[model samples]
Target: MESGGWTIKKRSNSSNDSLSREYVAETGCLSIVVLGASGDLAKKKTFPALFNLYRQRFLNPDEGHIFGYARTKISDDELRNRIRGNLVPGKGASGEQLEEVSKFLQLIRYVSGSYDSEEGFRLLDKEISKHEFSKNTKEGSSRRLFYLALPPSVYPSVCKMIRNCCMNKSDLGGWTRIVVEKPFGKDLDSSEQLSAQIGELFDEQQIYRIDHYLGKELVQNLLVLRFANRFFLPLWNRDNIDNVQIVFREDFGTEGRGGYFDEYGIIRDIIQNHLLQILCLIAMEKPISLTPEHIRDEKVKVLQSVLPIKDEEVFLGQYDGYTDDPTVPDNSNTPTFATMILRIHNERWEGVPFILKAGKALNSRKAEIRIQFKTVPGDIFKCQKQGRNEIVIRLQPSEAIYMKVTVKQPGLEMSTIQSELDLSYQQRYQGVTIPEAYERLILDTIRGDQQHFVRRDELKAAWEIFTPLLHRIDNGEVKPIPYRPGSRGPEEADQLLERAGYVLTHGYSWVPPTL
Candidate 1:
């Protein structure tokens, strides 16, 4: 129950070749069933990630098996071919590893069944039994993991089937975990209802709510940067900080997935899941232990403590002609751009505004967090007031960390200028392929490291913070401001920060370059 540090249990029979390999092997032989496995998510991310894990020998000798369930019927050979096509064995993967991966992919079994049908589930059970018998993995009951990679609408029914056929009938001693992806629900009420339904079949501890952003090395390093170093611990609060900015922007429009984009838009897609998760990491109080519960508890507190945003402080917008996309329905009010300022009502962050902005179809592409610090109150830098000191964590394109501080110019005029102590990943680390977010997450799930996984209460609190705004949007009380296709969102977004007494670090530029 202690949550201060990581709790790793040793598996008696399983071991890896090396410490690094051990990290993978300790997960034990896993029987993974990816529902909707033939879908885009499965092809693009899931299979490729699993292959990476396999290449690392994270699996056992009788180490692995993946089941793909969908309405379409496909042979194992075809599934292997499909998986191989998506994999990029560019680096960190050898020809032998690719051959092994292909061999492992042959272990993938596909099931064709409707989600709501009893016969479908009965058939699914048959497939599981077939894999178990084929692999002769009956020495000890292997772990069974169900990854619901389908849309949220189908989630409840799929979960119900799993409960009726899979969880109820399957052997209980071995670990059974279910992974649910986002957006977990449309709003707070839906989120709570979904949580209750999931809790019915799976305990909170057994459910692994996946938020891919948390799996990134840079994101996880945030904890190390704050807790591991003495330099940052003292200055990480309102006393020395000015404000925080979290931005996730995209240059391309909906890309013809407009129907799907219109339903949730930027708020639910990015701000609710990605941006808020990042904010919690930046704002949370240190947990007493590293248990999923403790870390999530701290994260939930940060989310719950985020004071409600006033109408004037929150801004929403839709890109021009967004509703005109063929896939979008008529009169769609979904916003493609959202910017809101939150005031955390906690001792460490009281009165400090955490500005969150996320939008699609912006100028440039970026996902970054900027932490700004207040200037030395009324002292030395009055004559050279440039801007607040900042630490920017760039999450994509070129992953890097930069700190802005005042440094003296080479010439001896006693004049000081601000410069960045930059740590660029692309520059500093050479010839190393930064593993994809999916790669890390899939591996973490196998390792049972819940530090990067979202907890139940954290999900609830996140929805609570944005519930009011969501309600307003549903009721048509807030109309989205329109911005150009190739710009940095609406003018109101600029005004939102300007009114907060903060300025954009790079003026009002496009979020990313247009494709």
Candidate 2:
């Protein structure tokens, strides 16, 4: 369908034969069940993404239905009303767009249900089955997708409930899949335990461990940028690259989620999953093929190549007034900010440092990957004083990819100044709506594409790399240094960055271009 400046082709119902047979089921009646529908994730991300798909006609109203299951006791209309405002269209939405939003809202039916109780799940199943039968889809030919947006603590019991009461009636040309949110577990052992519980109920192909960062446009562009481009093939390794930085910064703290944030610090909340996934894309060897399994294999190799994190190269911080949150304990040792250096013990990245940093209540909000290349070896012009070449990929706040280079000052002084070759998405792709991370990911789930999702073994390798450090932090062996709320995180983090070979680019900032 063509709308705005983009054309979204309707996804084919025929499955790819190369993928596992279980996932090769014909796309029949699609029933999307959102568990924890009353939670923030559902209203903020899940529902909004589904609404986008519906608006684009990717979701067929004739064969698709949405069911919201949660512990909150509310009628379908009440649930719709709760999310109606959030399902808003772009600025200056016309009456037709408003009507489309209303029509999408009507497809959602709410079923109040506890996570672990059999009765609640049975009722949810009954509602889903009713919707399926009402469509008169062929017997044993209906697709079911369950999205678990709740905490990891409830995953096991919820999976069991889903297996027992909510699976499709038959396996013939029909499938049941579950999409799980992250902070998968506190550490390696716990992650494995949770994995085993869910694994018993569903096959690997049926479970999608989603990391929204993987769905970002720039992140999704990593493979094409690295493998498809001739310019980066040789310059992407330790030989030409000095250091790589993957950073996530949020201008606000955990306002109402202090209780939950206290349990998982910045490392678990952002670095372990989001930043690491970006790192894998930046560092992994080119896969033999673009198949989901092939791509994931390369990611696992990258994670497995990560060397142990060093204490001297790590910095942790907690913003001032974090303890003021009523839900947070007075003595909570959680770190709202962290900076750590990871070395990959592989041929391509042997001496290069992968600096990962994340923080809350900082100076600004943005996530980006900066790849700083080495200084020119034979520079008679002495451009070294200006700055080294770098490629910065901004993941949010006006997405972009730009290359920093030393260029002659406009005045013919023969002196060099730093400038960039910018590809800011908003400016370059005007009037084109870049799909949200959740929107792309949810569409992938419906299409049975696991390329962006974390595989089982990939998850295991990621946790293994951080489990030791997480344990140390949890045991009070490594305490966080306190920093002011509006300021950049503890100064020690900057020192760590320098020590890890990251050169500071003084007096230069690349601003996103305004249209």
Candidate 3:
């Protein structure tokens, strides 16, 4: 098959026979339309990711053209210049790499339009069609990918415009797909309504619900770590695991995003989608195969097995001076921090507590999944004194997976100390540049892979688990406790963790090893 200028031929290798096949689009020119091109998300993530893909040759410069669509009236050059500062070159980048950035910027074209009107979309479609027809490709062989970087409020109308004015004209091998960003909705009913709005215009297969966390390197490795490892197979259940904690923390508060942050808070912004997706992967049973359907089927089952969150198991907090932001209301009950325990009523995790914790303006900045193992039934050396066995998967700020185990102290007199079996990505994979989450996900969308993107049923199940709790917070039935900005969330959160059977190792900290 021909993609842009590159040829992809299938090879029958024994090692690759079991690997999932890549879905290549039909022979044609490709057009990527960024709907909210004037927005911050477009400038910071969307364009940069596309630039990286172009640099890596995953996007063919000759055939792929990017169209930036928004209400802001800016020339193509102005749009390019707005995003140029963010297209940073990697360390030790050569002159050729800098030149490539310039070339990638040239592929972007800008169009001014309203999200709800057909006039802008018609002009946008005309631009895309002209590009598609300019290529020496066969009729009905063009691919169109629409990325909606706008807010959820505009999604329905924008989607209506796309369906009415921007759909692919040919019914041949060509296709049109739309990628929508989260938060999908504020609650369950709203999400369903939003889904119905889009579902009217496109099929489920054409809609890609993106959650950036699934593209994280460590989060992507969860399946292989669980199913491929012999040692973890038997120990990953209620029998040997004590508690699992998925945590997200940031040292800085909502700087200027108080208006937006005030609406979603920590739970809707982080826990409901990002952290919950990680939880599904951690607790889900292995799928029968690596197909997208099989994997998502298992994830839905995990979500369904989650028991309702109890009031006692939940803790919410707002950092000090949060309301001081001009955009946030003084009487806002929003939570900048939250720690909640989710229990799965399945055989593998029946009795184990899956702790989901996320907070802003905290003591540190990091995201990690900590799986603490049960202590040995009869401890001969009192290994539990050091710490319970733990497998810590750091998701950001230096990706690594380390196993904390009790090791004999390196001295004549035998004593136990906790040490790690570490696999730090930077140290282990020296020259490798891990792709950004947006970079990988954008490539997946282009390749027609729905493995990492959320399915509609999956989104529904996710909303189901958090809607009741969210409504209570909305009604002021549950209030947020106040805590100092630089401190770890409310003291009650740690107490909740302890109540959930998490054993904190007092005198030990595992630092990421340097070269």
Candidate 4:
């Protein structure tokens, strides 16, 4: 049956063959359950993505349903209003866009209840079943997707509730899947425990641990950029590359969110998940195939090669006035920024430094993977530094790929200057709206694609690489340096790079093009 722009294809009731990763999401009777539907993540990201999918005709509200589950006793109108406030359609939203939103909200129903109780889940199941029954699916056609937007502290209880009361009893007809949001537990032990809890309810195939960075357009393109293009294959190694830096900087601080911000420092919040995922794409060996397992296996190998960061290799800092927020402890030592060097033990990246840097309230708001290549060995242009080539992959503000190349200055003097071969997504794909990170990932979750999601072992491997450093910070073995709230993160970050023989961006400031 055709629903809006997308045709909802039904799976056969007696098909013995398993669905391909891409085929897992192609169902007409889809009911998406958003666990923390009233929280900030649900309102700000979950709903907006669903609304966009509906507006773009990728989701048909008439055929699909969205269940908003939360403890708040909000009316349907209140929930819609909250979602509307967070959604800011690109400049051209008009009559069609406004109409689409109104229609999309009709498909969303809010269920107010506790995350741990059976009664609430039963109510949720009834709401879901009512929608499913209305479709009168023959069998093996209706599918359910659960998204956990709540805190990790409640993951186990939520999973238990779903298994005990809400899960589809048989994959004989339609399947059931769950999408998990991160910091995927604090460290190794917590992550394992959470995994165990979810494991008890759902098999690995039923779980998708999502990381938003993997959904970014530029990040998703890393594989093609490296493998498809011959230009990079030869030089993509420690031999030709000087150092690699994956950076995430935010110009704004926690902004009174100390309650949430103080719980996990910048390391767990950004570097360990987002920044590290980018590194996997940038450094992992090419997989034999593009299958989900194949791709995930490569990421695991990359993580496995990483050596634990030493105390001296890490730099931590807390932004000033962090304690001024009442939610934060007066003497809290939680870090707002961290810069750590990861050395891959494998031969290809043996001596190469994968510098993962992230911070809140810094010089700019951007996430990028900068690949700095070794300087040309011999250059007749004995000018200042005989410039090194750098590939900059911007992941936010605007998505883009640009490379620094040395060229002769326009003047009569035989001078060299750096210029870019640009491919800014906005200019390159004019009028094309690149979906938000959450939107793409949500669609993937529905589709049952695990290519971009984090696997259980991958999580443990990443935690292993950073657990020691985290212990140091938590145990007071190291104190985070204090930096002014609005400045670039601690000055030591600069010294670390310089000490590692990194030549900073000299003349050009890597700025995202105005979208």
Candidate 5:
């Protein structure tokens, strides 16, 4: 099957010039307001992404500007210089390209504002308006985007204040969208309440729920790999597919996020949002079209159709406290890790078990999806034959897709051995720079494509799948099995899968390095 939009091709000399000129020409009048200007995400992701987009001519000249909002009293030059240091280009970034990115950096400005005050928001509106004009020389209102990169505790207040004073007055005649970062809520009820409050100000369509995982090239390729391939469709059911395994593990511990980690734990922090979203992409029925609503609808259906997990089948783990540079509190119950088994009740995967695992501070760092197919029934063995077919979609450290199938061993020997058919960006594609998660997400918001963006119902459904486990974790009714920092999670994680006749191969290789 032909790859979707991900197949990178050499940009012809003319095409490269066209794209560069496009960047130069379209740097039109558009405005981006980052609510948490001094935060890490703003410094590392927001400015760099806008600069890259601008450098790529994704924005026209004089087309837009960026506003960084914080309580700090830094000058525009200070902000520009600070962001410039972080704007180092990805591989293959030419000096000319870096120069282009620096030019876009000039379009950025800063504003001082208290997140909760009307005066602060009013001042912000004034700043945006003043930048929108070229002293009566520029015409037409620019598109406006407000990105909330703040902690969840203050998301609601900041969003409410912005809507009331800043964004409410904008008449861009183009579009206005608000981007809300992750950890949607403490639980389902809270997420629902927060959603209601935000919905009061911005329409659901205008709210972009950010989950960086959806922005990965290969993660997006999941949809293409499934729907675009005619070969996999007929055998994608329980009868032919044995099980699905998703692993999202980090090599390092909470990195001083212990305070926040203590509140949400692993189940809510990763499983509820990141891992479940990945599961939906893998297990959901194909949508009629690639529109955001249709795709999310299918994902929600998969979540709703999943059979509830029984007490014995679910496994949870917590890492031993670490005295890292960012101190982790002693006696912290925050799980750095968790493993879960979900059985789908739908017709397609009636008996298949979807094993999900994710954690922080592990033995190694790795993320991927493994699809184990049913072995050929009543196979005639050439020798001591035990053939298994597996397809793995690796997401990080290295991005690639590999499939294992039995092949005849070369030589006169009629022996069969498992061999891999692999496709990895690093090995196959040259001079290609894959975009960061935020870059793709920001572009999607601008392109009006919600296909990769999460919607309200999808979030609600995801919370439903994990709400019981959340309560169990909170009440201490569910005892968390403990594991050391430099190892795969508690032995229980392995047993959870072992009891179901499966083993977690390569668990050692998947541990994060910080462990």
Candidate 6:
């Protein structure tokens, strides 16, 4: 499961090693261009994130502006309306807040542009340049950031257009960067091609390969939980852990949005990139430093140790009535649910099975990583009766980290029950607003922090791990089973877990933080 002809060459992309994080963040006048501005992703995520950052003053209103570029021809007011519809001013926003929204709208401007054409990009460059000239001419240099909210089909052309017409390469005091979302590519070859396209125009530092899942609060805390807390240090390997499961389930189906969902399936959509990235963080050797490269370096090392997934270990399923959606093909076998076991071939995780399961249209929408430990060697209580210690890192529906430990029952009887040591976001951070994953990630991009972003070499290694399995599913070598719409998943998923020695214990589920 390794990529050939692409020898690993790690290059730091920092333009100025002298620039401090604070300086990089606060010194420049920033301009953000959302490529697919009129679309759902821009309205639902990109614009809302910029608005929040502006509202909080992380992005200086005077020094910042947002440009919306898309093929849709719309007036500035119409574009603002699209953005405002998604930006709920919250429960009881103040008049000042309302005014801020109005002011933020002023900073937003729209331009109808073709993704592949230089003419439109030149027009976009003009709009961006106006703002750059407006900033203190003698002081801070203007920065340019492009957010590709459009489809991957247009990335190559759009990237070329940006480099040709929009980059501010002369601004040594400032910087230029672009943020791209995943499915990085269709598979290994396509991903490499996309990487090559981006690499040609932008340096590693200038490219932000975004995986919003990594921006999650709990995900970010993995470092502190593993290194800062001594409880997990010695017990984080196969010596203590029985198995690991990264499970993501959505209570609602894509419905009309099956067009995108069907094209990629569960593996490409969630498992390959998101879940595998989480696995790397959970299994990596302790990094030498908290530097972004050091952390990413360790993450890449973990991926290199992963063995290719065996098709026999894969369980794929399609939900009932999935074809009812017009977007999905009538005879499509694209899997809505998939569960696969990945084995890491290194000493720490040699025999440990890292199971990743993701599905849509289930009973509840939740994401969590469950680590089940091996049985106690000499237990006073029956080994089966004694609950093996389990750690759960919940990513959504409420972020939380909790451990289920066996404790003596309150009654006179010496029976045992599971009790939790938990850290729930809501309970701990009173009256605080943890920004959405997009918000945190967008802010990180603005601040030039690449720690959470994926790198080309890392992405290539990830694709190498799953490309063969993808080819099997793509070529109809394996057929997807059918499951009920609201069920957890196919019954075979449960069977697969049992065969892998992962216990689906009952009578204990952590209460999530109040949303």
The number of the candidate with the highest TM-score is 3
Model 3, span 1-515: residue lDDT tens: 45653223333556645664755536778889998998999999999988877776677777779999999999999998898888856677788877888898889999999888899999999998888878875667778899999999999999999999988877887788999999999999999999999999999999999999999889999998999889889999999999999999999999999999999999999999999999999999999999888999999999998888899999999999999999999999999999999999988898999999999999999999999998888899976766798999999998999999888889898888888899999899999999899988987777777889999999999999999999999999999999999998889999999899999986789888898
Name model 5 segments beyond 4 Å from true: 1-28, 89-98, 135-141, 168-172, 323-329, 382-387, 503-515
Lowest summed lDDT window (length 10), candidate 6: 1-10
Which lDDT tens digits does candidate 2 get at residues 74-126? Answer: 99999998888788766788899889989999899999978878999999889
What is the number of backbone collisions in each predicted candidate, taken in the order shown? 15, 0, 0, 1, 24, 0
TM-score of each: 0.89, 0.95, 0.97, 0.94, 0.88, 0.93
Error of 3 at 276 (Å): 0.3
The RMSD of every model to the true structure, in order and in angstroms, is: 5.2, 3.8, 1.8, 4.0, 5.8, 6.5
Model 1 C-alpha lDDT per residue in residues 1-515, reported as the tens digit of each score: 11111122333544531122223322224578898887888898888877766665554435456888888778767766777778756678877767786677776788788999878888877777666556554533556778888998888888889878875234534567788889889999999999888898887767888988998868887876777678999999999888899999899999968988888878898999988999999999888866666888888889888887788888999888887788997788898899999899989998888999999889989889899887667667453356667898989877888887767778968866667887888777777778878877766675666877888788888898888988898789998988998898999788888777574443222122222
Quote the lDDT for 46 in model 5. Answer: 80
**What is each predicted model's overall lDDT from 0 to 1?**
0.78, 0.88, 0.90, 0.84, 0.76, 0.84
1-515: candidate 6 lDDT, tens digit per residue: 00011111223557753222332223446788999999988888888888877676566565667899999999999999878767757869788877888888988999998998899999999888877777653333567789999888889899999999998857556678899988789999999999998899889999999999999988888887888878778898889999999999999888678998889998999999889989999999998877899999999999999987888899999999898899899988899999999999999998999999999988889999999999878786764554578999988878788998887779988787877888888888889998878888987786678999999999999999999988988899999999998898889889999899887555766776565
Candidates by TM-score, descending order: 3, 2, 4, 6, 1, 5
**What does the lDDT read for residue 294 in candidate 4?**
95
Candidate 5 or 2, higher lDDT: 2
lDDT of 6 at 112: 91
Structure candidate 4, residue pairs in collision: 140-173
Model 6 TM-score on a 0 to 1 scale = 0.93
* Native-to-model Cα distance after best TM-score fit, residue 159 in candidate 4, in Å: 0.8
Which of 2 and 6 is the better model by lDDT?
2
Residue ranges of candidate 6 with Cα displaced over 4 Å: 1-27, 90-94, 138-140, 169-171, 513-515
Best-performing candidate as measured by lDDT: 3
Predicted structure 3: lDDT = 0.90
